[model samples]
Target: MINYKSTLIPALLIIVAIACNRPKAAPAKGNAVWDSVLQNVQTAPVKEEDASECIKLNGQIQANEDHQAKVYALASGKIKSVNVALGDKVQKNQTLAVLQSMEIAASSNDLVLAESNVAMTKKNLETTKDLYEGNLATSRDYTSAQVDYNKALSELNRAKQVQAITGGRNAVYELKAPLSGYVIERNISGNSQVRQDNSNPLFTVADLSNVWVIANVYESDISRIHNGDAVSVTTLANPNTPLDGKIDKIYNVLDPATRTMKVRISMPNPNNTLMPDMFVTVKVNAQPASSMLTIPSQAIVLDNSKNFVVVKDAKGLHKKEITVIKRVDPKAYIQGLSAGEQVVTNSQVFIYQALSE
Candidate 1:
């Protein structure tokens, strides 16, 4: 009786295990895997973008056209008077002032003496010609008189030119504007001493119709900039408004110290509001495109080892390295990234922390 009970209990234990272990309906392997995949797709979390696609680049603002003219006297002299003041508008051929020059006075006196000599020689030549025709004077005497008269005539003409340049006696040296514009600089006072040897400009006149915006571009990004490309500029003085302009020049030489290249933009200032050497922010636009593969500019994580992006994968957040091709206005054209895939934008640090654990 004890042996039968033990054997029956063992058989009952095996039967119970088989019944519990067997699948209820023997599901198909293909369908099971498909179902599991479907579940994953439904439960997978969407990544929130931590940053926007916008790329903010630094730049500067300035004028399109600007020039400075150094005012100097052709003949050295003491300043007799100054007619214009600083920031005064002068016209072309407008006399700025007069000057009293000893050199001019001497030239004028010499011119007067030359004129008198020429007149006297002309009268003497006339008398000699009459005497030679009447057989009262020799041909050699007439020739000598003729030579003197010719020399006197030449000297008189040269003297007249000198006197004219001196503006009569005390060279009324007039500093005139070459072009009609404002006097932006004044290096001389009412009686400031000016010299030809000195390099300092006595006065400077500038036409502030247009100005140039000079921008410093990084060494790596200089290729995008080309001559005649479009550009925009801004200033801290006028933050909201961006002044429109174009790419006028791209400097070939790179600055080794700053590791930057120079880019120039020309902008108009009809009201003469813009000045030369004003601080500004500049934006240089390369080309227009219909569409491009773009990503958030700030989404790119740069670490010591590599540059990468966090992707929302099936298991969890994954960081993958990427290559950036072009950085346009709002987005970055890049490779090693797929479209329509959710990426983490906001709270990247927190997500990365969770992923690290």
Candidate 2:
């Protein structure tokens, strides 16, 4: 203890050096540090929107059945030639295929026989009329000749009508399109045998000017959807381009295996962008049950099984707890936030964490 003052001086010098070198503690929340962070954050006002819940459902693009035509072979024959292919655009009454059929050949033969019989009967009638005029033939003979000629003429006309109905020329049946459309299916090929009674269509042509979006709604969501409900559709091929339409039909029946009902949305496809069988996503903007408060979904932060929104006031930014009613893209229906209040949408999580800490 003789040199206590001298030793204390050295110890105080070492303590001062250590204190000067120590790192500074972080700035407190709601201070200058947070002010800088808030400058970069983005905010939006809470607004009230109609509480129309969006029901997302899977769908498939289909040809409009109302505008589709199924082409069938007129008679049993071997396909002589296929004039069109699958996905070929055709006009109404355009020849699709040629079939060489025995039925048509038989009709051609019957027509020839009718024509020959008519010529012979006409000659006979002329001869009988001359003989009757010269008093060499009886009136009954003239009448009989006239009657036979008339019968032959009737038979010839019937043969011609049958040929027209059969749609055959020169013993070849020509399959013609009933409507103007793109061929969506082709079941017959060159040299393939077709039966007169075959139930399947030779080709399926559909007008793609309009299309149907068939969406499947689960049983639980059926009550929320109805006919004439507005909807938007997106496809994997062109997701950025959304087509809008209304639900024109709702199938009252449900698929037992899927336990879902189908709703039909009719949309105009002016560009033919929507193709049949293409999978799509459907968003039905169902009728609003009521009105509710909404905010940008990004403003809401989830933490510890609770939702919070960073609300800015005259004082500073504060994390306020909220109850999320539902979350649709870009907007979230929330409670505990009033309309006109500004909430941070960008970098909200970082600010929330800083305030919580």
Candidate 3:
């Protein structure tokens, strides 16, 4: 009763100690001022996308066979001059090489002999006709002259046809391009001997305006890929820029040696950027069997072997555990997230850690 001031002071001190030991309250929901970390966080809405699996396979760039031409010598000859080199662009019917052929020379001689015989027979026929009209020649003689003149004319026409078929002009044969394209192969040079029986082509011209991407798929993947499936192709020369295409052909036959089936994708090469035999990577977007929710790959946070995404809503920021079905670059197909929901993408790990704590 006598020391009232001292008793009150001790009691107040005890109360202040208990308050210091108690836990601090969490910041209010959606209060940016209280949660300074929210100021730097970025968010994106979850999207619903068709679920798909990507099948990566090795591929090659090939010139379209439809627009390619293999030039072969029609006759045996010595190549006098080659007007084109490998990689040179040429036009249709452009002279590629000049060949001096012995066969052509023989044909020319035959043509000359035929023309001379025709001239001689025509003169004889005229004389015989005149004689018959004057009763100095028999009717059989006139008929024989007409037959001889007709035979000579036939021989002359045959000679001309032989020369035309041999492509012989002035005893020389000119090798010309069958189509307008770049000469991709040149096997003959000036003074080289060529034979009609040669199996190898003398020159190969290809139109680079359209090309094909031939990709190989494993045996296990054959059932997954189909015609009309979308694909992305990238070459070593241009890896960053991917070219879009579709699987236009599926070679049903499998390679016995490789145990893989081949698929073909057609692409337009307007600038001639795609070259023949260029190695490439092909990514086939296989058709989806169902739909799933998608989010930015960066939004995912891995902790304790579990994936989580920090979701932001009107109530507050919260960490929700999610299951990842697949991950394509820049996108992660997932479960446990709804479309149109916002999730933190940037600085999400920090936000997730804070939310977990």
Pick the lDDT winner.
2
Using TM-score as the measure, the top candidate is 2
- Candidate 1 is scored at a TM of 0.61
The 10-residue segment of model 1 with minimum total lDDT is: 37-46
What are the per-residue Cα lDDT tens digits for candidate 3 across 93-208? 99999999888888889999999999999999999999999999999999999999999999999999998777786669988888999998889978889998999999999999
Worst 10 residues of 3 by lDDT: 7-16
Error of 1 at 307 (Å): 10
What candidate 1 gets wrong by more than 4 Å, as runs, is: 1-68, 163-171, 212-223, 249-267, 287-291, 295-357
**lDDT digits (tens) for residues 116-146 of candidate 2:** 9999999999999999999999999999999
Ranking by lDDT: 2, 3, 1
TM-scores, one per candidate: 0.61, 0.83, 0.77
Ordered by TM-score, highest first, the candidates read 2, 3, 1
Candidate 1 Cα deviation (angstroms), residue 291: 4.7
RMSD of 2: 9.8
Better of 1 and 3 by lDDT: 3
